[model samples]
Target chain A: MLEQGKIDSRQAILLIISLVLPTAILTVPAITVKHAAQDAWISIIVATMAGLLIARLVTDLSLRFPGKTLFEYAEEILGRVPGKVVGFLYIWWFLHANALIMDEYASFLCSAHMPDTPVIVFFILGIAVAACAVRNGLEVLSRFNQLFLPLFLGLLLVVFILATKDMKVTRLLPVFDKGAIAILKGAATPASWLGEIVIFTMIIPFLNKPKEAYRVAALATLFTSFYLLVSILVAIMIFGPNVTGHWIFPTYNAVRVVSIANFLERMESIAVAVWMFGGFAKVGVFYYAAVLGSAQWLGLKDYRPLVAPVGVILVALAALCENIVELLDFLATAWPPYALSVFEVGMPLVLLIVALARGKGGEGT
Target chain B: MKKIAVLLLILLLTGLTGGCWSRRELTEVAIVLGTGVDWMEDGRIRLTVQIARPGAFTAGSEAGARGREPASWVVSAEGRTIQEAERYLAMKVPREIYWGHCIILVLGEEMARKGTGMITNFFQRDRQPRENIWVMVTRGEAKDFLETYSSLEKTSAQAAGFLERMKTGYSVQLWKLAEMLASKGIQPAVTAVEVKEAGITPEPDREKKSPPQKQVGLAGVAVFKEDKLIGWLDPYETRGLLWLKGEAMKGVIIVPSPGEPDKAVSIRIRRGSTKILPEYDGEYLRFMVRIRVEGDMVEQQSREDLAKPEKIKTLESEMADELKKRATAALEKAQNEYGVDIFGFGDAFHRKYKKEWRDLKDRWDEEFSRAEVNIAVEAQIREIGLLTKRAGVPEE
Candidate 1:
C-alpha cells in the first residue's frame, strides 16, 4: 500500500463534508438563486438527491474492488492503457476542482475584506498550507478537519440565527412561481457542488471498515445538502428573491447583515475565519486526492514527492479565472455538465456498469 | 518537535504572506462617520463625507488646543458617478478613506428626485459600510447636512442618526432600501430630514447670536416611484402607510372626546398587526385591509367617565375611525396622487394570485392605482392610567 494511514467511518464522513461544504456555501447560493429565484432551496433538495445517487454509484463500485482506490479499479476494470486515460481524467478533475476552491476563497477574501491584497497571496498561503497537509497524508488532513469544520459550521449557524430578526418569511412566498424548469436549472448548478461527494471514492479504500462506505456517503450527502439548504434558504429569506440573485456572495452578505444587540455586527470577520478553515480543509482533500492518484497512476512508491510540484500547478490553475465574475460563470454554467457531472457521476456510473458487465473485481476481497 | 516545526512553518507562512498584503494601520486611514450625496447643477453627483477627528474623540485631548474646530471634518467633490466623486474626494483627504464606521447616508432632495437607482445599486454592489447604515433624504443639499456642526452629538451625522433612532419616523437601512429598490411590488421610502434652527449662539467677535445654530430634524418620509422621489408623506400619512403595510404601529393618536366635543383624547398605540386581503372581481380588484390595535389612554382632556363600557366603546370606535381615516388618506395619496404602491399591495396581490401576477407584474402600479381599497380597523384599550378618569376630574 502506498498510503498506510486509516480513517474510521465517522472521520470519512467528516472528510467528505469538509470537501464539499466550505466553497459550496459561498458560490452555490448566488448561482442557484439566480436560476431558481425564490425556489433555489427546492433546487438544492433536487441537487442533494442527484448527489446521493452519484455517491451510491461511486461507493458501490469502489467497494467491489475492496481496499482499492478509484485509480486502481480503473486499471483493473478497463485494462492498463485505457484505464490510465480514465485515471488521467480523474487526476485532472481533482486538480481543476482544487483550483476552483482556492480561486473562490481568494476571490471572496480580496473583494470582501482585503481588496488591496493581490489574489495570488491567498493562493500561495492557501495552497502552501494545504500542501503541508497533503504531504503528511490523509490522517493529518481528516483529523485537522474534524477539529475545525464543526466550529466553522457552528459560526455559520450563529450568523444565520442572529439574522433571524431581519428575515421576513414572506420573502420566500409565491413558491414555485418560476415552475419546475427553473428549479431544475438552479439544482443543476449546485448539483456540481453536491456531486463533489464522488471524492469519497478515493477515501473509501482508506476507511478502516470498507463496508461503512455507504454510511459515509449517506452522512456526507445529508450534511452537505443541509448546509447548502440552510445557507441558500436563509439567504433568500433575508435578501428576498430579486435581491438575492444579484449578490456575488449572498450568504456572506446575509452574514454581514446580522446586527444583534448593537454589538454582534461586522461578523463577516467570523465568515473570513470560516472560509479560511474551509478553504484549508477543501484544498487539503482535493490536493491529497490529486497527489495520491498521480502516484498510483505512475506506479510511484510514495505520493509525498509529487506534493510541491502539484502545489505550484494548482496555484497557476487557481489564477486562470482572472476574477470572481469569470470564476462564477465557469462554476455555474461551464463546469457542471462538462466537468463535474461527467466525472463525478457520468464516468462513475459508466465504470460501474462496465465492471458489472465484465464481472471484473467481483467481491475480490 | 515535528509538530512544533509544522506549526512554526504555518505561522511564518500566514504571518509573512497573507496578513501583510492588505494590512492597513488605523492611523493610515480616515474614518468616515457619514456619507452625503447631492446632485450638482450639471446633474453630476457631489459626494460629501464627514470624517471624525481622532484626537477630538479622545474625550478631552483637544479641549482648548483647537478652540472652535468641530469634532469632524467635511469635504466634498464632484464627478459623473459616486465612484468618480469618491476618487476626487480621496485626492483631498490625507489618508485612505474608510467607510466601516459610516453609520448614515444622506441623499440631497435634488439627487433623490433625479433618481436614486444608481446610488442604491452602488451601495448594493460595494462591500463596505456593509449594511447598518440608515439612509435619509434631506430637504436641502446633503453637503449642508454633512457639514453642519452639532451641539447635540459629536457630529451632524451622529445628530441625524439620533433623530432617526427616535423611531417616530419611517427609516430604512441600506439592505432594506436595496431590497425595496430591487423588489418590483413595493417602491422605496426613507426617513426625511431637514436642517432646522435649534437656538441662537452668541459670537464673542460679533457680539450677536449667530444665525440660529442649525440642527437636523426628522421630517416625515420621502416616498418614491421606482427609484425617483415622487413626494413626501407627512407624519400623519406615514402612520397610515405603516398601518396599511401591517408594520407594528407606534406613536400617539389624538381624537376628539365623545361627549366632550370641546376637548381631545390621546391614545398611545402600544403595538398592532394588519392583514391585507386582496379580492378580484370579474374586471376590477379590491383590497380589504384589517388592522387590529392595542393602545392605552395616555391623556384624557375631557372627564366623560372614560372608563365606563359605553364610553370606552365610543372611544375605541373614534380611535378606529381616526386610524381608518389616516390609512385612507395615505392610500389615496399613494394611489391617486403618486400612483406608487409603497404599501406593498402588489406584493400582497402576488402572494394570493400567483398566476395572475405574471400579467400584472409589468403594469402593477397601474393596476394598484385602479384597485378599490377598503380599510377596516379594530382598536382595543389595553389599559387606563393611575385613575379610571382624569385626576383633576370629579370621580363617579
Candidate 2:
C-alpha cells in the first residue's frame, strides 16, 4: 500500500478535471469541426452528456467496492483467470492513454514553440516530471491540480477576452447544417475524453468521501464541458469553421492574434504555460493511476517502486508514434468509440452488470 | 546521506538536460520581416524576403551610420515550389532563416492573377508563419514593392505595416483569406499596394539633397473570384465594401454641399455600422443593406455656415445620398462586372435561411449576380470640428 493518504471531494473533482481537460481543449475543436462544421459546439454538449453518463456508471461500480479499486474488486466479482485478464486490459488502457497524452504534449510543444527540438526531449522531460509527482503519491498530484487549474483557467479567460475583437457571431450560424447524424459523429472523440473519467475507479478507494464521488465526477464533467464549449466557440467565431476544421490547433491560433497595441501580444506564451502545467498535472494523474493499478494487480505491497519503471515504459511508448500526423489519425478515426470506449466505458459496464447479477454487495465489506 | 544522494542525482540530471536541444542563438539566425511572392516568366515562382538586419537597428552602427543599406536585406530566388525557392535563397544567405517574426506577405499582381492558392501552401503548412500577417497584392512585381523605403519608418516592411494600420482599406490577414477561399459563401478581398515616385516635388532644404524618393501606398482593394484575383476596386468603392463589411473605422467622404453648387464639404467618418438583411418573399429573394454612418464636418470651404440646424440636416441628407451612390457603385461592380459575392451577402443569407441556403450555396455567385440589392444609408453629422461655421471664408 502506498501511503494511505485520502483526498476530499474537491480534490477528486480537480483531479478528474485536470486529467480530461488539457488535451481535449487543445485538440477537440479541430476534430469535432471536421465532422460537425458550424455545429461543433452541439457535438461537444452531446459528448459531455455521454461522458457524464459513463462517469455515473463507473462511480456506481466503484461505490460497490468502497475500499477496493477496480483491480481488487474484479477478481471478487469474476474468477481468477478472467479477472486477471480484465486487470491487464485496464492496465494496458491506462498505459496507452498516458502514452497518447505524452505524445500530444510533446508534439504540440515541438510544432508550436520549439520546432527544432527533438520530440524525445519533451517525452523524457514530461515523464520525468510526471514520475516525480506520481512518486509523491495521489495527494500531491491532487494538490498540484488544485493549485494550477485556476491559473490555467484564468489565462484561458484572458485569451478568450482578447480574442473577442476578431470574432464574428455569424460564424456559428446555420446550426444543424450537416444534420443530427453528423453532430453525433463529431461527438465521438470528445466522448472518449469524458469517458476517461473511469480512471477514478482507482482513486475512489482513496477518497475521503466515496459516497460523494458520483456528484463530484458529474460536476467535473460539467466544468470540462463548459470549458470545451467556450474554446470551440471562440475558435469557430474567430477563425470560422473552414479554418478551425483544417488548422491543427485552432485555439492556439486564435490566441496568437491577441495583439492589443503590441504590449498584450504573443499571448501564446500564456497558452504554452497552460498547456505545460495543465498537461503536467494531466499526465501525472494518469501516471499515478497506471502505476498504482498495476502494482495492485500484481499483488505488490507498495506502488511507489513501480512508478519509475512504468514512467520509462510510458516514455518509450510515447516515442512509438513517429510523427504527429499518425497520432492525429489514430485520435480521429481509431481511438474514439473503439479502443477508448471499450476500456473506458465498456469494460466497467460489463463488470457492473455481472456484479449485479451475481448478487455481490458492498455492505459486507 | 539519502537526501544528499538524491540532490546529487538531480544535479547530474539537470546538467544533462539544461538547455533546449537544437537551440539556435539570435546571432546565428536571420529574422524575415516580410515575404513577397511573384510569378517568374520562366514558369517558376520567385520568393522575395525582407530579412531584418539586427545590427542596423543600433544607432550609429556600420550599416546605419550613413544609411548605406536601410535596415533590411531584400533577396529573391526562383523555383517550382515556394519551399524550393526558399531553400534556394537560403544557400546565398549566411544565417538560418527565421520566419516567426515575419509580419507581412505581399503577392505580386501576376502571381495573384495566376491564383494565390499554389504559393500559400508553404505558409499554411509551416507553423512559423503567423496567421495574422498582413496579406496584400502589389500592382507590380512584389520584389520592387519590398524595395521601396520611406523616411518615417526604419525599413520598408515597417512602412508597409504602418500604411496598412492606417485603415486605408480593409486589411486581409493570411488566415482570413484562407477562410474566405475555403468557404463557399464568401470571397476574398485584399488591400493593393502601389509604389510610385512621390507626387510632391521636393523643395530646397538645408539637409543634403536626396534623389526623388519612391513611396509605397495602399492603392485600393483587390477583389478575388475564388482564389484568383479578378479586378480592383477604387478607393471610394473600397470604402463602400468596408462599410458593408463593417470595417470602415475611419475615412473621409467629400460631398458637394446641397446649397452651394461648387463648394465641397469633407466629412470625417467617426463611426459606422452595417446590417445585411436577407428578405425571402416565399418566392424570390431580395437583400436589404442598412448602413449607419456618423461623422464630423472637417472642411467647409463655403461661407454658408453649414453648422446651422437646417444646413446640417441638408448636408446629412446629401452625405447619405453620396454614401448610397458609393455603395451602389460597389454593389453594381460586384454584381455585374466580377459576379462575385465579396461583400459576404451569401453568409448573411446562410445565417438567415439555413435550409434554403444549402440549396443555393453551390451556385451562389451566379445567384448573387441576378439578386436584387437595396441600399439604405443613414448618415448623421454629430460634430463640426473646432469651429461651428466656416473658418477662412467670410461669414455672411
Candidate 3:
C-alpha cells in the first residue's frame, strides 16, 4: 500500500463534529418537536448518550486493530467474503446518506427563499462544491472546517442574543407532558443522525494519535449534542411548542420572528446565509467519506478520480426525491431504525465482538 | 490550449445558466400590497389583489400622468381554487404579482363563514408568502376593506401596516394558523377588519353634488374552529385573548372604581405573562391559568390622595379583578358558544399531562367545555401616570 498521510486527533474530531452537528441543528429540532413537544431538548440528550455509547464501542474496536481501517480488519476477523459484503453495505450507507444531505439543502433553500429557482440548481451547486472539497483530500477538508467552525458557532451565538427579547420561558412549562414514550420515539431520528459519527472508525487508522481518538470522539459528541440542545430550546422558546411542531423549518421560523426594531427585521436571511455554510461543510464531509470508501472498496490507488462521478449520481438522486413532503417522510420513517442498526448498533457491535473473540487484543498495529 | 478553451466554455455556461435561474429583480415585479378573498354571489371565490403601482407610487409625477387613483391598483379575479384565481389574475395584470412582500391577507366574513381553508390553501403551499403575514377576516366585502383608504395614514396599506405593528390588539399570522390547524386541541383565531363610514362631514353649501364616500378602521377579531368562522370578539375581548396568549405588547386599560362616578383609572401595560398549569383529578382535568401584569398609571380620574402605597394596592387588586373577569369571559365564550379552544389550553394540557391528553384526545371538545378552569391575575401598579392626582382637581 502507498504511504497514507495521517490526521491529528483534533482534526479527526473536528471532521466528525462538522459532519454530524449541522444536520441536527437544522432538522432535528423540528422533528423532535413533532413527537416530544417541549421535551424535544431532552430527546436530543438521550440521543447523545446513545451516540456516545456507540462511539466508545467503535473506538475500542479501532484501538485493538491500530494502523488498519475497519474494512481491512473485517477481512482478517470475519474472513474475506463476508468482510467484502460488509464493506459494500457500508458504501451503500454512505452514498445514501450523501444523497439525503443534498436533498435537505435543496429542500430548505427552495422552501425558505428561492421559490422560483429550480431545486436542481441547488443540487448541482452542492455537488460541485462537495466534489471540489473531496478532491482536495481529507486534510484540506478538515482544515477548511476548522477555520469555518468558529464563525458558525459565533453566528449561532449572535442569533441567540438577537432572539433574547422574544424568548418565553413559559413555552417550556409542564415538561415531559407526553410521557417518556414520546421523548424516546423522538430520540430515534436524532440518535440515527448522531450515529453518522461512526464514519470516524473508517478514518481513525489515518489519525496521528490513535490512542487519543476515543477521547476526541467523545468530546466532539458532547459538544455537538450541547449545540443541538441549545438550538431546540431556542426554537421552542421563540415559536412555542405547538407552532414549532407545525413549521417545516423551526429554526428559520424562529429567526424570522426576531425583530429588534424596524431596521433589524427580516434578519432570517442572514441565518439562511450562515446555515448555507453549515450545509456545505456537511455535504463536503459526507461526500469525502463516500469517495474514500468507494475507492478503498474498489482497490483504487486514489479517491480523487471517483469524486466527480459519484457527486453527479448523488445530485441526481437528490433531485429525484419526489417533493418536500416525500423527503421528510423518507427521513422520518424510513431512515431511523434502518440507519441505527447499520451505523450505531450493528456494525460497531460486530467489530467489537470479532476483535474480542480473536484474542489478538490491541496487537494489529 | 484544451484546458483554457474548456475553462472559458464552462465559465460562459455557468454565467448563462445562473442568470436565467435568478432573473427576478425587485423592481420588475409588482409587490402585492394586500390580498382579499370573498365569496361571490355566484358561489365561487373572488380573489382581489392590491398591486402597488411602483412607477406611480415611487414617482409622484406618474400618478398625475395616468389619471388613476392614488396608492395602488386593484386586480380582481374569480375561481374555484386560489391557485387558479391567481393564474386568472396574472393574465389580467401587466406585471407578475409577487407575494413575497405581501403583508396582509384578508378574508370576507362570508368566505370566512363558508371556510377559510380554500382561500388560505395557496398561502400555505406557496413558499413566497411569509409565514408571519397577518391574516384577518373582514366584516364586509374583503375588496371593500382593502379599497378603503384612511385619512390619518398615507394609504389603506399603511393603515393595515400600523395595525400589524401595534401588536397589542387582535393579530394572527400565517404560522399561527398552521399551528392551530395542526394542533389537535386548539382552534384558530385571526383579527377581523370592519369598514366604518369615514366620518362623513356634510358640506356647508349642501347644494354641491356629494363626493364619493370613504370607509376606515379595522377592529374586533374573528374566531374560527377548523376553517369555519364561528364567532366574533369585540375589541375588549380581543385584548383579553392577547393577554391569554401572552402577546400583549402595549395597550391602555381603564378600570372604573366603585362608588366614584368620575374615578376611572387608565393603566399602561408594561409587561405581562401567563402560565397554564394542568392537573388531573380522577376523570376531571382542571386548568389553572395564572396571569401576572405590571403597569404604570397613565391617567387618574379622581382627586384621591396620591403617593399612598395602600391606595396603589387597592388599584392593583381592582385591576387584577378586571383582568380575571375579562379573561374568564373570553374563555367562556370561546369554549361554551364557539366550542373552540383558541387559548391553546389543549396544547398546554397535552404538554403537561401527555398520557391523559392521549386518552382525552377524541373527546377534547367535550372535555374542554366541561373542564374546570381557574383564572388568577396579579397586577402591580408601578407608577401613577404623569400626574399623581387627577388633572384639574386639587390634591387632598
Candidate 1 lDDT at A268 equals 86
- Provide the TM-score of chain B versus the true chain B for each model in turn: 0.90, 0.93, 0.88
Looking at model 1 chain B, which ten-residue stretch has the lowest summed lDDT? Answer: B59-68
Task: Give the clashing residue pairs of candidate 3, or none.
Answer: A177-B351, B297-B385
Model 3 chain B lDDT-worst window of ten: B60-69
**TM-scores of chain A in all candidate models:** 0.98, 0.98, 0.95
For each candidate in turn, the TM-score is: 0.95, 0.96, 0.89
DockQ of 2: 0.79
Query: Under CAPRI classification, how is model 1 graded?
Result: medium
Give residue B19's lDDT in candidate 1 (0 to 100). 50
Tell me the deviation in Å of residue A34 in model 1. 0.8
Tens digits of per-residue lDDT, candidate 2, A1-365, equal: 55488999999998888989999988888999999999999999999989989988888998888888999889988878899999998888888998999888888988888877788888888899889888988888888889999899888988899889888888999889889999998999999999889888888989998878878989999999999999999999988898899989888888987788767788898898888999999899888888998898899999988988998899889989989899999999999966556887788889999999997756421
Docking class of 2: medium
Which should have the higher TM-score, number 1 or number 3? 1
Residues A1-365 of candidate 1: C-alpha lDDT, one tens digit per residue = 88899999888988999988998899889888898898888999999998888888888889899888999999899889989999999999999999999888888888887787788888998888899898999999989999998899898888888989888888887889889999999998778877888788889888998877887898899888998999998899988988888888899889888878677788888888988998899999999999999999999999999999999999999888777778888888898887665898878888888999999886623
Model 2 ranges off by over 4 Å = A1-3, A363-365, B1-17, B59-69, B199-209, B281-283, B392-396
Query: DockQ for each candidate?
Result: 0.78, 0.79, 0.47
True contacts kept of each: 0.85, 0.93, 0.56
* Ordered list by DockQ, greatest first: 2, 1, 3
